[model samples]
Target: MAGPTAAPTRREPTPDEFVAMQQSPEFQELRSTFRGFTFPVMIVAFIWYVVYVLLATFLPETMARPFLGLNVGLWLGLAQFLTTFLITWIYVRWANANIEPRAAHIRQEMEG
Candidate 1:
């Protein structure tokens, strides 16, 4: 009876090959779209969060002033919740538009 055949050798990719994969146009395009959406959104979200903190810290009198019978701080705090939902919605929409198609394209290219 013949023994089981030896398993084929599987070669790991080299560092240069990994770097080449990263620097490929398809990968670069994916990185560009992901970063473009994330960085801007993150910067804006951080700025918004900082502003909320500063207002709650240094601007007590103004934040305590009434708007629609609720203090401005309360309304602004509520606005933070709204902002979170809004940002999530925007990110999903942006990902669908700018990232998903490119990712799917790259996946198809890889698999095919």
Candidate 2:
């Protein structure tokens, strides 16, 4: 009926619409908090990696030993995985505490 109902035309989001979606106080604070958490983590991870390289290069004697049949490098490599898991855990906690409330507020704002 109605010539196949002519699919509804979708409008592109304007800058104002984009700003309204992302510029709410709750969303702005959420973005800032996440950036704050992530930037420090990135810096720490970079420093840790640099330190690891330095140890492997200049302190091979110290890192050359085996721990539990795995070489020091292997152990240190596993530590990186552990660190990633820890970061994920921290992010989950942060999301629950800091991100979720803001998200709920945004949803209410958008819906209401």
Candidate 3:
């Protein structure tokens, strides 16, 4: 009969292990920075969109504006699209500059 293979040895973590493995301050800063930047923008955008919809639905005259032959509804929709793209761009830049590195560090700490 073949002998059983030895189990892999696992070293106990030292107190310094936690210090080495703690989340980076940059990670928290990035999180709070994004939260501060995005929360208000998201709230304002939501309010603006809701008000636009309400106005368009309740007051036709208010929404009756011409833009390159398109009416207000179409124009507002286009504006919303543009706004979405802009927000996406901002988020991507934030992620690349701050979030990605922080996330990588977190993942490394978890894995280690």
Candidate 4:
């Protein structure tokens, strides 16, 4: 009778292997596209929120003034909420168009 055989071991990828994975065209495209869309939108959204806060804090009188039957503060405050939703919606559309397909291709490559 033969002795039982040992199970095969799984090797972890090395740091060089990890870097090569990121250097792959599919991964690079996905990373670049995600960064390209998110960075600008994030910067714009952050600046917009900061400006509104600064204006409300330093120039309260301007915010208190009425526009479109609502105080300027109210309009600007509501705009913050609207900006969040709009940015989320745009990112979703961008991911669907640009990110998902490349990610799927990478997934398929991994599987195959």
Tell me, by TM-score, which candidate is best: 4
Q: Each prediction's Cα RMSD?
A: 6.3, 4.8, 6.7, 6.7
TM-score of 4: 0.79
lDDT (C-alpha) at residue 59 in model 2 = 89
Give candidate 1's TM-score: 0.76
* Deviation from native of the Cα of residue 110 in model 2, angstroms: 2.3
Candidate 4 stretches greater than 4 Å from native: 1-19
Model 2: per-residue lDDT, tens digit, 1-112?
3455676655566677668989777678889998998899989988888888898899888798988998898799789889888988998998899888888776665655
Give a tens-digit lDDT track for model 1, residues 1-112. 9999998665566677667777899889889889988898899988998999999899999999999989999999999899999999998998899889988776555544
Cα lDDT of model 4 by residue, 14-78, tens digit: 67766787899869878988998899999999999999999999999999999999999999999
Each prediction's TM-score versus the true structure: 0.76, 0.70, 0.67, 0.79
TM-score of 3: 0.67
lDDT-superior candidate, 2 or 3: 2
Clashing pairs in 2: none
The number of residue pairs in model 1 that clash at the backbone is 0
Ranking by TM-score: 4, 1, 2, 3
- The lDDT of each candidate is 0.86, 0.82, 0.77, 0.88
